[model samples]
Target: MPLVRVDAVAADPQQLDAIGDAVHAALVDGFGIPADDRFQVLRGAAGDRVVYDPGFRGVDRDDGAVFVQVFLRRGRTDEQKRAFYRALAKHAGLAGIEPRNLVVALTENGLADWSFGNGEAQYLDDPPS
Candidate 1:
């Protein structure tokens, strides 16, 4: 399962929902994640609270920048990761997110790093098929 965090500036509920759905779609299509394995935290901060370098990496960002972070178990190949990035950006863009303003980061861990509930590492205790 991948835990997704999306931080945007002055986004509405519909926009947040669209972005979250786009992320889930990318995860399922690009990372081979199950369609129902959705876990997300979507936050829309004030414009001042969401800061970014307008020219970071030569990409011109703006006040409408969005930051997306995904945490998941490690094992995907480099090709898969590249495809995921592309797919994510495409899906998010279709949701009205700007390409240059979209920032995505992925953090991968192992099976022992997750706990669904009951204060237990579910992945370790009962691996998914």
Candidate 2:
């Protein structure tokens, strides 16, 4: 399961929702992840957080398109991340845009225990199980 957090500048609520849906589709439909697995997507405004280099001027006009950064438990290979980035770019309607223009960050973490069940039951902490 991947917990995705999307950060962008000047993106509207509808666009944010679309971005989240696109990420989920890329993970589940494209990556073969089970639908029941945990996937959380959080959207943050660009003004709320900085998304530019110190000497860089904004390339996105009013930051119209959403910029995304993904975090997941470490285990995904470099090729996998590249593929995911490509898929995300396509899903985010950024196919023609330069890859460098798109910002994608991946954070890794050691696996930990998690459960998604009623109080009366317990389940194994297998991702996509």
Candidate 3:
């Protein structure tokens, strides 16, 4: 399971929802995560509220830049991560976001780090393979 947070600069409500769906689709197709295991928080930030270097990493970004952060369990290979990035860009681009404006960060943790209500570490009891 992955928890995704998307912050788009100068995006509207419809774009935010499309971005969320795009991210979820990437998670499922690229990472092989369950399609129904989607959890996300999408927010639209004003242009002035976001800060970025237009030429950072040799990519030309603008006010339409989007920042995505994902938190999930650790186990996926480096190859998987690379594929996920590509898949995310393709999906997000289809949602009208420029591929160059997309920024994704993944944070990995262990099963013990999660608590899905009831104060229980649910995955600890029966871990994923």
TM-score for each prediction?
Answer: 0.93, 0.66, 0.95
Tens-digit lDDT string for candidate 2 (1-129): 567787656556776677777677666644556776546665657558655652245444334444565555567777777777677767666323333345666777645533444542132344434
Report clash pairs, candidate 1: none
Model 2 ranges with Cα > 4 A deviation: 44-49, 54-62, 94-101, 113-129
lDDT of every predicted structure (CA atoms): 0.87, 0.59, 0.92
Give candidate 3's TM-score: 0.95
Ranking by TM-score: 3, 1, 2
List model 3 lDDT by residue over 1-22, tens digit each.
8999999998899999999999
Angstrom error of the Cα, residue 1, model 3: value is 0.6
Higher-scoring candidate on TM-score, 1 or 3: 3
> Candidate 1, residue 77: CA error in Å?
1.7
Model 1 misplaced regions, further than 4 Å: none
Tally clashing residue pairs in candidate 3. 0
Q: TM-score: which candidate is best?
A: 3
List runs of model 3 lying over 4 Å from the truth. Answer: none
Q: Judged by TM-score relative to the true structure, which candidate is superior, 1 or 2?
A: 1
